[model samples]
Target: MSVPLTLAHLVWRMKHVHPGSEVVADGTRLRFADLADAIVRMAAGLHRRYGIRQGDRVAVLAFNTLEHLQLMYAVPLLGATLTSLNLRLDSAAMVARADRSRTDLLVVGQEALDHRSVGPAVRAAAAELAGHGITVAAAAELAADVETELPDLREDVTAFRFHTSGTTGPAKSYEVTHRDVVLHALSQSAADASGLRAGDRVLPLVPFCHVNGWGLPFVAALTGASLVLPGHDLTPARIAGMLNAERVTVAAAVPAVWFDVCRHLAELGTAPPAALREVLTGGSAVPRSVVDLVRDVLGAGVATAWGMTETLAVSTYERADPSVRAGRFVSLLEARIDGNSGSPGEQGTLQVRGPFVVGDRDGWFDTGDVASLDEEGRLAVHDRAKDLIKSGGEWIVSAQLEQHLCTHPSVSAAAVVARADPKWTERPVAVLVPRQGRLVDETELRAHVAERFPAFWVPDAFTCVERLPLTPVGKVDKRALRARHADGPVLSPDTPGGTR
Candidate 1:
């Protein structure tokens, strides 16, 4: 009953069983059978024209599009590892990642080359690779001719490698085998919290460069779901229109995208597309306010999942029960809280062991997140251990402070970072983004936190801005905030106002 679980198997099954299922992109759509044929042709082109050998590293710099999806499948079929470059990275970062991966071939999407910011990054990468004689081709040029057969591939071969967002430090490259990809797809498809099923239409607002859009493309193929890609059009209005036009049943993106979409819908005096049942969010903490807005205004349930590039997109997904606030580990993953003190609701570092999960040590992968396991076995993440601030020899959870700050009526976004202090080793500094047409007073914001949390847990300073800096994948750039404010004045509640 056991057979090799490679992407080739998934492609053949989808092509044969759901040939007519559609995949909608920017202005084009293709059936599963056609998509499979295109992937084959592209694989052949990469092998013959581009000199892509088995086990070679192929890097793709592009926005989410139909062609990008084809490359996602094609590179794996060629027995090569696909490295998706984050389009949001600057030119230097892109060049650094391409070089670090030792990429043998680079494929650039025409749309990305036309982009003002991404174009320069792609050109810089191309220029650097030229010296190495690595082939750089437009994605469109690789999709012709469909007369090639799938190469014999082993399930254990590394098929995908994605770099971290580089927010905390230098981005690290994580590798996943073909079997890892296949099992992750199956696990996601089987999770009821995923809200994915046959005949359903799914749109991934997340970029393909980020964990292959959290593995939606493969999940869609395996479950016979219609895949809808947004391409380079990430505007809230455009995304709302697509949700309505495509009748998307399941969608996934970061919390920021959902917040913008909800705001756009409200501005138009509209509700979520009636077809939308679940909106899956991850990549960062989901604010409770956003969750309430999705339920009350958008008429959809918000499902929060947790994972990273190392865990293969998803390690845990929220349970279906309304009372379960945290996610439960997927069936294939085993999770434990390291350094637990054997107390009720004790928090510790989360460690996971799974077939597809990667780590430097044995089978165990440290997630670098502080979490607590509830009586029901649901895992609630507290914060990143690095993001935790030590003040007066006490640990302060920045996520908790940010959550409280976001509850303020005028605060739309909040980030907390550690500032070196002469007295305490470090002190917490709060950065907040104000809601449109509203201004947040530092004194009042500090009071809001002081009332809710212990007096010592209150932030030492508060900075209000029009917006918070975000990383490539839309998570708050706490590192950038710390760098910007580390040398600035440390305000107190008595201070008139904080830095802008």
Candidate 2:
């Protein structure tokens, strides 16, 4: 039960916990031994078929299904680094990462690309990718290989690469080691059984990106917890059905996924499937309204964990206490704020370090989020700290600008992107999706934001829209937002790079 330092030890632990029992359950199931055998054989195939030597990069682009998890364990079993593509990234970003990591081969799943409308740029890039070949494989193809001695991932070697999500420039690839995976799994393990435990059946909506999904899948394999994998699509109705059908005990995902699921549950004339026990949400903001509704209606445990692909696990939260039903405000992270190094309490950059933390320290990982620690000792992420605008030499948090704008009675949702501005370096621009049929004009929105936030913090222009673009992981796609409104006449930046 001391965290499986080596993946082989993790497998041994899995066999010890549930050996012949189902570790991954789709409509049917595969036992720990079944999974173990499959992973071993696949590792052999990777070596024999593609020359995937230990430490080579093998990329997988697919939804969260049993096969993805198989690849998750198998890649490392072969001592290769698994590079998970942000399925939402258009082909160009995807190709760039493939190039950066120098992926040896790409395995694409049918379900994953079924709905993708990747651009021509990505197509060209994928075609010219230097990898041996791009393989379009399926669950059926993987079931055949089941006999071989697979090499264990070198704990000291790079085990995977996490991409930057590329909301700004092209994505950057960062390596994660086998040691990182083991320690991360350890960190998620409850020091006193307060977090995860044996016999806990978990329903995970996060994709098998070797990031958010890292710890949960192993819960089933390493601790005899049942894993219900929801293949890619996270429709509210589908989520409700899975929660009810599987009687999932533990659930995790970004807030937006749950936001829709919660709405679906309301539509079905029921609260979150009564069988559900605890829910963990992150990857985006949890509005006070959403938190209030979950507490009042569902009555199930809901906790928020903050993490990044870079760190591999939860670094900090405004709230993570067991005693308090603090929806998402508990501070699991311990750190200090030193002036402009970060915001004071309620507004500063969040810098964190811990056993599970992943970062290229020169030492700290600048999360680019502007956050504040409330009097209750909870951390609230206001917005990306990088998204801040310096107007007249003072900081203007776009999140504050957006929050104020959204508060206007006629507004439904609002976002503030950095606009080009030569004088202030940058300024805020409001993009609003008005409440259905109700008209909230740009002038009204500007006046509304100005009255609430400081004048310097006010947005210089407005771009009305029906919805905000989202990154593959489901957070607001600010990169696209910047591109959409970057060239507005209201503010002109000195350089073209800042324009978008």
Every model: Cα RMSD to truth: 2.6, 5.8
Worst 10-residue lDDT window for candidate 2 reads: 322-331
- Tell me each candidate's TM-score: 0.94, 0.80
Error of 2 at 351 (Å): 2.5
User: For model 2, what is the C-alpha lDDT against the true structure?
Assistant: 0.64
Off by over 4 Å in 1: 319-324, 341-344, 489-500
lDDT of each: 0.82, 0.64
lDDT tens string, model 1, 271-320?
66889888888888877667766776578888888888887776677835
Q: Ten-residue segment with the worst summed lDDT in candidate 1? A: 491-500
Backbone clashes (count) for model 1: 0
Q: How does residue 233 of candidate 1 score in lDDT?
A: 73
